[model samples]
Target: MPPNLALEIKCRESERQALLSFKQSLVYRYDILSSWTTQAKANDDCCNWIGVGCSNNITGGDYHITRLDLHNTGLMGEIGSSLTQLSHLTYLDLSSNEFDQIFLEDVASLINLNYLNLSYNMLRGPIPQSLGQLSNLEYLNLQFNFLEGEVSEVHFSKLKNLKALDLSDNFLRNCTLGPYFPRWLRTQNFSVLDIAGNMISDKIPRWFWNNLSPNLLFLDVSYNFIKGKIPNLSLKFKTMPVIILGVNEFEGTIPPFLFGAQNLDLSGNKFSDISSLCEVNYSSPLYLLDICGNQIFGHLPRCWNRMLNLASLSLAYNYFSGKIPHSLSNLTRLKSLNLRKNHFSGEFPSWFNFTDLIVLDVVDNNFSGNLPSWIGLRLPNLVRLLLKSNNFHGNLPLSLCNLRRIEVLDISQNYNISGTIPTCIYKFDALTKTLNASEVPDYLKDLVMMWKGKETLIHGRNLQLQRSIDLSCNRLTGEIPNKITELVGLVVLNLSRNELTGQIPYNIGQLQSLDFLDPSRNNLCGENQDRLIVQDLLFAISSGFIIGFWGIFGSLLLFKRWRLAYFKFLRNIIEKPL
Candidate 1:
């Protein structure tokens, strides 16, 4: 080999030794880099190490390290300064690690980096402003970190080529005087941007939305303290595909243009009305819409049939009244629907054919009339049905047993509803067996239920694959069905405050997974009552015998002549009762 080629090989070996030193400083539980241990034997090259890659130098130069991906490798250590040795690195990922107190100054030296991810780490302290020096960066993710302090313009001003940026779930707060919108982002072009779960408290500036880059497609600012109303959006620019402004303090009517977004989330606010959204000409590819936990009132408008792409719709915890618009049946793609905690009255709307419905919650409403038996026939995929605290009356339709996938069923607090619970309740297959972990969906319906005598808020994975049956606070009469004991996977059972007669099922103990059980304030009696009577009788007999024997014995001991007469009387009583 040429003398210059030999010198290049020696230099590359030195850089590899530096990287091995950096790994030694970490606390790795798994042997993800078993090849890293072969360096001492000179049998392995640095480029062949796990999570390491080398670049092909076509210019007759030595190959340099270009990529280092150690994501979810169970590494626990400080991001040591030794990483600066890999000057030619273009991609670096150390996400889902336990690296604390990172030295961003060391990372800033990698000027050729194009993508960097440090998410899901124990990083603390301020994001170094030296990161702005990486002009070639295209993607940067720092989510799920303990990073604190402000993020000034100096941290990203030079990164004009950045396409995606996420800084969510951090303790970083904006120290601005007015609006939380960062002024530095006005000039940069970004396709995806997320700053959720931060301490940003201010009104969104009017210019922020109007001046958004035409390439902008997704924006998330949820879970902040942002206040004030959103200005009328201009349609002159390209329409955004996704926008999330949920869990904020913004109050006022929702903008009509928001309905045009494919995925829009405006839940947990004080918006009063959304009728304008229906009045507008919505022609975008709408998918998911969430406006729950608001004070929205008025009947749902009838102009929603055109959006055929809708899947999940949530308008719960609002004041919407009157019947549901029948035109909603046209959207055949609907999957999940929530209208709970409203003032909607009159008979339940049985017009819509929800063939793909999975969750239906209409709790805490003034809905009256008998529950239609067509629920199972119309919605075969139903899993959770919550209709409690309503005025519905009449016997539970036996056809409800046709819902084989039902997991949660609550129809309690209907004062006029009467009759025995159906014996075919065990047919609910979802509640018959213990739900496997894989059967639980990632996102389930959210409902506020009276569980275990307390109001419980359940949703998402917490409510997934859980079985419960609530039929309390009603005027129903008849025996508690013995078939209910067959539901070995039942999680909660409530039958309190009812006029039902007959004993609780003898096999109630068969529900091994039953965590909560309430059968109080009912006219039911069973072995429990018999046990109480037997205990009382035994106590009475023992007390009377103890008192009478002690009274006679004390008298005999006090008087000598009486003692002799008592013995004679006992002998005479044994012979004859008089």
Candidate 2:
């Protein structure tokens, strides 16, 4: 072998040994890198490790570690400093681990690192300023950590190659970035920037709209103490696809240009006047919009019908009044619609174009008129149907029983809805077993379950345990059908304040999973009354026998004359009373 080649091989072996130190620091129950053993008989090449990647350096003609991805490995323990020894590493991802107290300065030696993700860990302490030396970094994510202290501009001043930066869900209250929008962000050309769920209290600076990089595609600064009116952008964000500014204190009208964003979440803000939202460009392709919990008033703009790509729309808890625009049916891709706690009046539109809707919540509205049965026929995929606290009248639609995937059905508080509860409620498949639609988002599938008479919102975990039926406070008069017992998985049943009469179903005890039942103020009677009367008669007979026996025995023992007189009186009455 050539002298240079022999030395290169020796260096590779030594660097391979350095990797073992990092492996020892982590506790992997599944042993994701079980191949990383030290036995001579085992595969000694570090390149063969489960999450390690290697490539040959053309100049050095030796293999070097270039990537180390151990995300979601169930690994725990502090990220040991030995990882810095891999000087040739360009990609390092230790996300979704239990690593704690990870000091960024320890990994500063890896100057070649172009991608670093330490997100979703228990990392604490301040970010090390030495990270700024990694000029080659293109992606850096330190989100969802316990990190504290300031993160000044100097920490990222030299990262000219950075295209994406995420430091959300961290304790950056003392960070020098903001009490206002970070001015330093203007110097960087970030395509993706997320500083949400932090303690950044600041007004969105005026320059933010004018100076946004044309290359920017995604921006999020939600869940902060940001306050002020959003200024209109002169330069149209033609290429930007997402902008999330929800859960903030931003007031005033929404910028007209913002309607062009494909994915927007401006919920939980104090913004008012949605007149500009009605003027979105015809060609705009908005998909997801969550402007709920805002003070925005006025009717929905007619332009909403043009958003053909719209999927989810949440306008709940707003002051918007007037009938739902007929144009909404034009959004054929609509999957979820929430207009709860609004003043939308008039009869609900009978026809709808969005047949694939999964969630529809229109609770606490002034909607009067028969709930169009088309809701069940048109939206067959309904998972959560919340229509409570409305003026909807007439008999409950029997077609609603066809919604097999429904997990929650709340139609209570509509006094005019007078009819017997549907017997086909047991056919709802989602209530029969725990739903396993993990493929969909959590917001799309959820139900308000009643456990021990307390209502609780449930989603994802333990959600399948919720099966409720609320038809109380109405004028409905009829006996609860015995078929209701078929819904053995029912967790809550409320038929109170209704005129329902007749004996309670004999099979009521079959609902073993039932946690709550409210039949009060109704004419319903219990079928167990006969059994209870028999029990009372048996108790009375037993008490009488015990008293008679004790009295006769005591008198015979203490008063001989009284006992004889009592016996004689009983014999005379038995012989002559008839």
Task: List RMSD in Å for every model shown.
Answer: 18.5, 18.7
TM-score of 1: 0.82
Task: Give each model's whole-structure lDDT.
Answer: 0.75, 0.74
Error of 1 at 28 (Å): 2.2
Candidate 1 lDDT by residue in tens digits, 367-446: 89988878778988888888888999998888889888887888988877788788999898878777533232444444
- Candidate 1 backbone clash number: 0
Q: Which window of 10 residues has the lowest lDDT sum in candidate 2?
A: 510-519
Clashes of each: 0, 0
Please give the lDDT score for candidate 1: 0.75
Tell me the tens digit of each residue's lDDT in model 2 across 52-140: 88888889777888899999998888776887789999999999888886657878879999999999898888899899899999999
- Candidate 2 residue-wise lDDT at 345: 89
Please name the candidate that would achieve the greatest TM-score relative to the true structure: 1
Point out where model 2 deviates above 4 Å.
Answer: 1-14, 24-27, 34-49, 55-63, 101-103, 171-178, 211-217, 234-240, 434-440, 446-456, 510-520, 527-578
